[model samples]
Target chain A: MGELRLMKGNEVLAEAAIRCGCDGYFGYPITPQSEVMETLMARQPWEETGMVVLQAESEVAAINMIYGAAATGKKVMTSSSSPGISLMSEGISYIAGSELPCLIINVQRGGPGLGTIQPSQADYFQAVKGGGHGDYKLIVLAPSSVQEMNDFVDLAFELAFKYRNPAMILTDGAIGQMMEKVELADFKPRWTNDELIEKCGSWATTGKPAGRKPNIITSLEMDSAKMEANNKRFQEKYRKMEEEEPRYEALMCDDAEYVIVAFGTSSRVCQKAIELARAKGVKVGLLRPITLYPFPKKAIAELSCRIKGFLSVEMSAGQMIEDIKLSVFEGGCIVPVKFFGRLGGIIPSPGEVVKALEENFLKG
Target chain B: MDIKDIIKPENLVYKKSELLIDTIMHYCPGCSHGVVHKILSEVIDEMGIQEKTIGIAPVGCAVFAYNYIDIDWQEAAHGRAPAVATGVVRLNPDNIVFAYQGDGDLASIGTAEIIHACNRGENIVVIFINNGIYGMTGGQMAPTTLVGQVTSTTPAGRNVDLNGYPMKITELIAQLPGTSYVTRQSVQTAAAVRKCKRSIKKAFQNVIDKKGTSFVEVVSTCNAGWKMTPVGANKWMEENMFPFYPLGDMKDSDKKEVSNN
Candidate 1:
């Protein structure tokens, strides 16, 4: 820990990026997440850490910029909201296809198109399933609190480079705007050229040295046979990630009969809902998925054997319930999975979630 | 002198650049891409920056540009080369960065990227090839297509009402305050090739000087796309394309005053 400071989630992310030796940040402003860039501009990381902070023309440009910087084996990141992230979908595919390691922070707002500035977890499907084209997946870290927002910034970068894939901090407006006291991590220095060459010399284009062929970073494989082989390699990497990286937390699930699967803000609400449900003798527990892609399927399936039913609490009408269904059914033990949610910036209260759980899952 | 003796270093008048690979270019015989590629490699080799230069290849005909240019390269999505170059140069400011794009990639789909990159005055070079048609996709009308030009898309010569006027993108770029140098050149004739090479060198040199957004637009010809013989296409480009996209330096902030008009 470096210093304890009260900070907003978006601001904490910016601070963590600078302290984590982020080499560059390229982004365009959108609602509910503009502070990420605003804070970086205010901090003037260029002077402090020699990090390059640029306000890109648009989200499309920003993501492609990440692709370029990451090609050089540098730590670069970008921040956007729902609409901006959608615009960056094409570039994100390119980044994923090229297998560049970088961080993207999506402080999600309500969507379908310019829906609202308030918080929503509607982007769960897009983040976990790969928002862009092709068979790919971003290592998504869902941060529910301001502290987690601060912590996940470093973790996301770590996982990104560990697997040589793009990582996303899938947060929402509530976490981005709220403030909390956080113990900041110690600062790390940016990697020197020699260090980059040592670590990423196999793939990164850090300028060709004598006696070696030039490194070309591109996703284009015109030959269909070769392209299929490349995709198989990516699939193998994704499978390894799934085995090693599925993360989640089970609260009060040791002897519970009914369970609630949630994440981000909804998980916080579920925390309160569990207290309410337990007092009413419902014996409900909460399973908060931290990594949405390498989804805690094994944990959820194991719980399904013990629990009577599961209620998926979410900010959207129902996005993550599909994954819950997949997990519960994987073991041939089909427990009734219900969804209680709101949409378009609507935040369900603890009382509402508890009532819905009782009416939907606990009644029978 | 014997044949072997005549091939001595002192007697040799010209040799291809080592920076260019021996692989055959996919371009047609008289297409300007090969000529342009050769000149670019020549400049990089002569400037002794081959090892330090990083090139961004666009998604047009020259997407395989990395195959020929023996330097660190990145192949960008169509029209995203400038945005990609922006990232490359910002992170690796010590290296020479440039993007090779055709009209369709730069002027049509990627117009905003190029404009904003130029406006921001990013310290990178842009090599734009205006062949009045999309060559790789086969004979489609490009944004730089001449008025009253015939193409697969504009079968009945381009009409302003239906297709709008051809974009004079180089002239528009020269007006941006961020651009330090802007020139429109061609490589149809031997003399023209020499001038075009000079323009390319100046563009690269401007980046070394830390001057922002040096743009070199080459009024090239797509012989196959234009439905003409290689020799005829060169002559036609001289007559038709030059009048619209004239050859010469449009702006040079290092030498003359620039207006952000």
Candidate 2:
């Protein structure tokens, strides 16, 4: 256990980055996540941890900066809201194509356009299903609490470097702005250039040493055959991730009649809904996915065999539910997966989730 | 000595820069990119920073610059070289970083990146190549294309109202206080090539001195894109491109002190 402090999700993210040995942070301000940069600037991590914090001109430049720094085998990241991440699509695609390791935190607000600054999980599809162009997938981690926000920063960087792919924390505004007690991690020193050269010299764009040819960082494969081969290679990595990285929390799932599948802040609401449903003598459980990209497909598929049905509770009309339905039904098992949710930054309540269960699964 | 003995190792007077890879250049004949690439390689070799230098290749004719220059390279998305260079220099301050960008990749779509990176006074070099038309993309009009210049996009010679005026981006960079040195040079003649090489060496030295952004714009020619022979293109560039984008240093922070004194 490290120091415990009451902090907002955004603020803890900044502190955790410093403690996790982050080399640099380049981000532009957007609602619900601006405090990420604000907190870094106030903490002056440059004076303490030697972290480079810069307020970029726009989300596009910020993400590109991550691409550049990540190429040098540095632990760097950026945070943004929905519309801001949308502007970063081009840079994100380039980063993915180059196979550079970096972290991106999307404390998602309402979207479609510059929708709202309130909490929403509408970006589930964008995060999991390649928000940027090209055949690539980000290792998506969804944190339900401020503690997870701190913990996931380190985990995100670890997974990013482990696979040499971009990783994202697909959180929402509620978790970003809400204050809670967090036990921070112990400080880890940023890797020196010598250490980085030792580790990632084979691929990283560190300067070319005497014996080696120059290391080129680029995503453009002009040859069609080569591009297809690269795509196939990425697909294999994603499959391996699915095998090794799917993470979820199954609460009261044993011998349950129906399961409530949710993630992020929606999972917190579903926890309450599980309590509410149980009070009414309903055997309901909660299945909260922690890794959204390497989704708990196998878990959901197994649950489909035992549970009567599933109710996906989310802050969006229907985004993650599609993945749930596909995962459960892939084996031709008709487990009766249904969706119940709000939209445009509206937080679905526990009562609403319980009502959805009673009306859809419990009755008749 | 006999003629065969005269061809001995000691008698060798000139050789291509060791930094240039033996790969056959893909640039079109008479294109100024090969000339600029040769000069840059020679400069890097002369500075003995081949092991420490990192170059950002642009998206136009010189997109394959990495194939020619035997140095660590990052292929930036069209127009994002400066931002990419910023990422490199900020993290590795000791490394010599520079972006080799064409006019379309710098002045148009990537205008924000170049301006912001300059304004931030990033300790890096920007090698801007302003050919009046896009070469790799089938001769399209570029941001630096002169008025009355005909291109694939401008079927009937460029009109100011329709196409806008040619941008003097180096001049714009010179105005920014963050820039320590700004110059526009050409590689058309032997004398011009020597001057351009000197300018590039100064830019690299500026990086070592931590003297902020140093921009060297090489006003160049695209003979294939211009529908002309190599000699014709050079003549046209000398006559038209030189007047709009004049040669010589526009801003030098070091020179300011001597002149002031």
Query: What number of clashing residue pairs does each candidate have, in the order they appear?
Result: 0, 0
Question: Each candidate's interface RMSD, rounded to one decimal?
Answer: 0.8, 0.7
- Ten-residue stretch with the least lDDT total in model 2 chain A: A328-337
lDDT of 1 at A83: 93
Worst 10 residues of 1 chain A by lDDT: A203-212
lDDT of 1 by residue, A171-269 (tens): 999999999998898999999888888889888887776678999999999999999998999999999988999999899999899999999999999
Global CA lDDT of candidate 2, please?
A: 0.92
Model 2 backbone overlap count: 0
Residue ranges of candidate 2 with Cα displaced over 4 Å: B1-5, B257-261
For candidate 1, what is the TM-score?
A: 0.98
Candidates in order: C-alpha RMSD to true structure: 1.5, 1.6
The CA lDDT at A259 in model 1 is 93
